[model samples]
Target chain A: MRILLTSVFVDDQAKALHFYTEVLGFVKKHDVPVGEKDRWLTVVSPEEPGGTELLLEPLGHPAARTYRDALVEDGIPLAQFTVDDVWAEYERLRGLGVRFTQEPLEAGPVTTAVLDDTCGNLIQIATQPE
Target chain B: MADDLFKALADPTRRTIIDELAEQSGQTLFEICSRLSMKHRLGISRQAVSQHLAVLEAAGLVETRREGRYKFHDLNTAPLRLIVERWLVPRTSEPEENTP
Candidate 1:
């Protein structure tokens, strides 16, 4: 009845695992080998380790590349993740050499910033008013 | 298959159409067009709506059936539910002794 998992297609699983876990601060929840070259890798936010999982699914299909490329070219974020503090998280990520497509911007009740996930995805970090 | 499903859903217009269908399932092309325009305030053409529906049908998010001259489109939420069950469903019943 609730959202349990969502996925963002990645070009490389190893690089994505490092960025998502080490830099983005999520914890590896699952990493089961699916085939010879791919794994069912997933990560969850540290704050909600038992909550929703983000699957770092492989971008193996030809259409996936085109879809990701189009979204990136149009400057649309691939996914949005909620954070407690947008500016602080943006600063910390920037310090880690993560390239941002959009700086922190406050719009109405939410503040948001978009950064490249380094795996063919532009991820957005946001903070909503309580 | 999942990639194509996601790709089909990636479009805003297509998402809106899906929303419209969710609101009222088993709608014909004309009914979908009218509802989209009146309810959602989307002034998209019939051809555009048809194309989006085609994509949704291909993704298995929608199914179509012909009743005489009219083709009715129904929302198929099975694929979406399958995705959730595949990764989200907790395997609490299974032993977790292998955890590292």
Candidate 2:
């Protein structure tokens, strides 16, 4: 299936906007208004065209609270996404002051790196598809 | 929630059900069954469909709303989107709402 958009819950929109665009190299797509201060914010990859879209969702829903909390407790990534070169992304992200909880580790043909998004969750960067 | 989502998606029948829901926008259980009747493509029973819906709901991948005597099931894009965002979308800045 063609993956369209992915989303994550953010505590603050302003911080998320900067981190995604300035630090990570993702370009802003839409910051449509949802409701008083609520937005349907989204972003897209710079290299890939009409490829992956990132949705900046607001957290406060009980369901998200539980899901995110459970992920944090279990020490399991909520999910993993593929990249062209995990190490390069890792180094690049590191240069920008991104703090990673785990350094890049190789497992079989795949290599992975993880970092704290500073939003109570850990993000995994994988070089190979799992 | 990820487990629930993965479990719900593990079955081909459940995936079919979800695919149908996606195409039709949301569907009542009764309507869902009705559409599946003519096709022998389904591998499971109606009861199984209910169970799948339950799992999906728990995963935050699908939601059910009560309307009159029937319950309408709609796909929740949160988990799917979150899964995609974490991998495909790069961190622009530190994600804002960090709830401890």
The number of the candidate with the highest lDDT is 1
Candidate 1 lDDT, A1-130, residue by residue in tens? 8999999999899999999999999999999999899999999988888999999999999999998876665346778899999999999999999977556755446777777898988787889677
DockQ, candidate no. 1: 0.01
TM-score of each: 0.57, 0.52
lDDT of 2 by residue, A1-130 (tens): 8878888887777788888789877799888898798889888878775788888788869888787866544234544667888889898989989966445655446676666566655677777645
Candidate 2 regions with alpha-carbon error over 4 angstroms: B1-100
Query: In model 1, which residue pairs have backbone atoms overlapping below 3 Å?
Result: none
> What TM-score quantifies how close candidate 2 is to the native fold?
0.52
> TM-score of chain B, per candidate?
0.82, 0.75
lDDT, candidate 1, equals 0.80
lDDT of 1 at A57: 98
Alpha carbon lDDT of each predicted model: 0.80, 0.68
